[model samples]
Target: MLVKMYYNIKIIIFKLACFKLALPADGATGEHEDTSQPRQVTSTRRTQVSVRGPDSPKIRGEVHAPIRGLKCLCTNAHSMGNKQEELALLLADTNPDIVGLTETWWESTHDWAVNIKGYRLFRWDRKGRKGRGVAPYVKKQYTSLPNSVGSEDGQTEMLWVRIQGGQGQRDLMVGVYYQLPNQGEELDWEFSGQLVETVKSRDVVIMGDLNYPDNCWEEQSARSDRSHRFLAEIQDLYLTQEVHSPTRANALLDLVLATGNDLVRGLQVLDHLGDSDHCLLEFTIQLRVSKACSKAAALDFRRADFNELRRLVGEALRSQRVRELRI
Candidate 1:
């Protein structure tokens, strides 16, 4: 049995040697030779990337400018009543200096809930109406006051605020406007008049839902007469629309219009606030604002010496007792 096993192993080794001798050498041209070059093995690991969506805000050319100026946010809330918490979250996340909201659907009754902590609210609600309203919230540090520069006797849903700028800078005129869809020509003219008056200022920023879907901001043209008029008005006033992304659906309804070319730096269209279909608009204004100073004084306990304080108190008590004994 051992001899038979050795014979079988020797036969297997002989076959293996015959097969190795029959194989072709490297670079030998034969029917089994491989003539193609070796393929490069690329890395299978993926690189992290961020892709901006179709509804993402168009980054303006002034992105490289100084980012130390005022940070502002605007959104057509559709109705701000139920979205205050969401807005508050957005406020905390963005830490904007100014916030403008259109179609707030606010009434005098909403005064109780409209005030946001660290921000002063200024609003213009449609008289006797429930749907249309505009509100602007300025940080508590900024000295902001309601103005009538861009309002037409409550005819249009608009609110204006004069924000005090830093030293050596003029006050910024900020307006929040909400143009009603399919409104009368008179209302359009009134809103246009408001823009005309507001644009007269050197520093002006107007933002809201204009509702002119036919106007293409990229081409700077409009098919409808109303959009054409608005486009023409913007051109005439030398106002630049910094928001290029679609705020509502496929249309660019929300806008951040600045009077001068340099007044706007960057604008971003963020996610919808709460359940509102319209997206949020975040932008930066090219003006420096004075920092808010705190009036309350705080005691510093970190550097305090409890032993020294007790010694001083005992000395004062002893001195008082000595004086009392003398008296």
Candidate 2:
């Protein structure tokens, strides 16, 4: 019985081995069964990304105050007589405190034609000639007077005006000049003399088409002798040329010169007017006008008219009751 039992045990072991061998291998069927723990599948298409650190700064916009001061607009209206409507439109749009125009092409015949409303016109029309004129329009509220100084031959056209400032502001001397491209040194000398005298008195702002393309305003140098002398004079007077960009075809012919750095701000070269080749210049004159004082008296309760006030109130109440009853 012991032998039979041992043989049966061997047979059972052989059958178990055969059954284990018949089973599939671990990866032969293209399947995985990880009972211990799930495996992480590696991917070759993964991309690396970066994140901002805690020290990174947050982006924001800058805040600035609104510009409040005297605004001025200047342009070279090659022939302003024919472009009056365009100038009018521009004045209406900008509403500047002062307007300066060079090459106005005005004569005695345009006396009544070039006047703009709400502005006191100070013009220097070319005498015995056709082209090359300068005009400055000061607002009517300010007291402005023409102080023109030019040659008898009308070679140097300079329109000088003294503008009375408001209560705390200083009076300003504004000059509008137009130098002929081919003008001789005599005209330049005359203009420089007058300019020096004007600057010696009060603060001055000179705006116009000076026709000095040879000037390098940034470097404060000039190629031509004429422009060199002019630059030297400007530097001696401690004046600053505010316009940087080109106003005409690849040349900064239009200029806005001021006595002090604080005198001018926000200088921009705008589009051309009419058929003119030069661009418009707009800037702020860093000056303020005081508000006009009104003569208004406040109510005084010490001298009360209570009896009349009560009577009016009673009448108004009775009238309101009558109207409500009628309704």
State each model's CA lDDT, in order: 0.71, 0.72
Residues 184-229 of candidate 2: C-alpha lDDT, one tens digit per residue: 8888889888877667635689999999998988898899888999
Please give the lDDT score for candidate 2: 0.72
- Residue pairs in clash, model 1: none
Using all chains and alpha carbons, the TM-scores for the candidates as numbered come to 0.66, 0.65
lDDT at residue 40 of model 2 (Cα atoms): 26
Q: 25-108, model 1: which lDDT tens digit per residue?
A: 221222231223222222222432111111111111111222358898888888888998878888898899999999899898
After the best TM-score superposition of candidate 1, give how far the Cα of residue 48 lies from its true spot, in angstroms: 53
Where does model 2 exceed 4 Å of error?
1-68, 148-154, 288-327
Quote the lDDT for 193 in model 1: 80
TM-score of 1: 0.66
